[model samples]
Target: MSQHIQRSIDSPLRTGLNREQLWEDHDKGLIKCWEVGRQRAARFPELANQCLAGELPVLGWKGGVSRSLKKLEKFGSLKYLAQWQGLRGEDLNIDLSEERELTCSRTAMVVTFTPDRSKYFNQVAEA
Candidate 1:
């Protein structure tokens, strides 16, 4: 029998994965998933961390990861600014216009915003 089948047949107590062990395993799995996400973000250094985090809300992208990144950039959450030093402007400017056009082609609405002094004053008063 396969190890998976053997594990399935074994009781939790016999297998040594008690409640605490099960919880630890669950936490480890979560950490592994988070590490994978971080690795992906590292591979695409041009994209913002917010873009990667937003993937969960949009249900894992379904082969639309590039589209999601463009949407984040369009909405101003992801800017052209570099997050770290040692990155050249020329290197980072890799066909962004084409990517943006392709990704945002199907977008229904694209909203851009700028904050005014009035909004800041209101926020200060509320705080």
Candidate 2:
């Protein structure tokens, strides 16, 4: 956990992205998700690294898009991280192993949804 926290401080996200602009571009579909993921990583490096390192599971819905997943996959645990780009309901989706729930407590974002809306995500978190 300390090392993960260190990585965030050591390698800060260099992109000069403004949150408002990022959201606008995201809404417009003009920005690639990977870049947004990078921004998230930069802004919240500790949480992002934690999720990537598998110290904790990070639940992502639309925010769990290819770009963010790709960015997060670099820290460690490729086995679980590799499934970030696949469609939902596929066997290749983010597998937490050992039937443990994939709950992302510290996320860059996208850990949204209620149990009623998505049982899959509810296991991740109640927020």
Residue-by-residue lDDT tens digits, candidate 1, 1-127: 1111011111122244455654345232222223333444557554434343322111131112233333343321112111110111111221212222212233332322111223223321100
The stretch of ten residues in a row with the least summed lDDT in candidate 2 is 1-10
Q: Which sections of candidate 1 miss by over 4 Å?
A: 1-24, 47-127
- Listing every candidate in turn, what is its Cα RMSD in Å to the true structure after a full C-alpha superposition? 18.2, 14.5
The true-structure Cα RMSD of candidate 2 reads 14.5
* lDDT of each candidate versus the true structure: 0.26, 0.32
Clashes of each: 0, 1
lDDT of 1 at 109: 25
Residue pairs in clash, model 2: 34-67
Task: State, as a TM-score between 0 and 1, how close model 1 is to the true structure.
Answer: 0.23
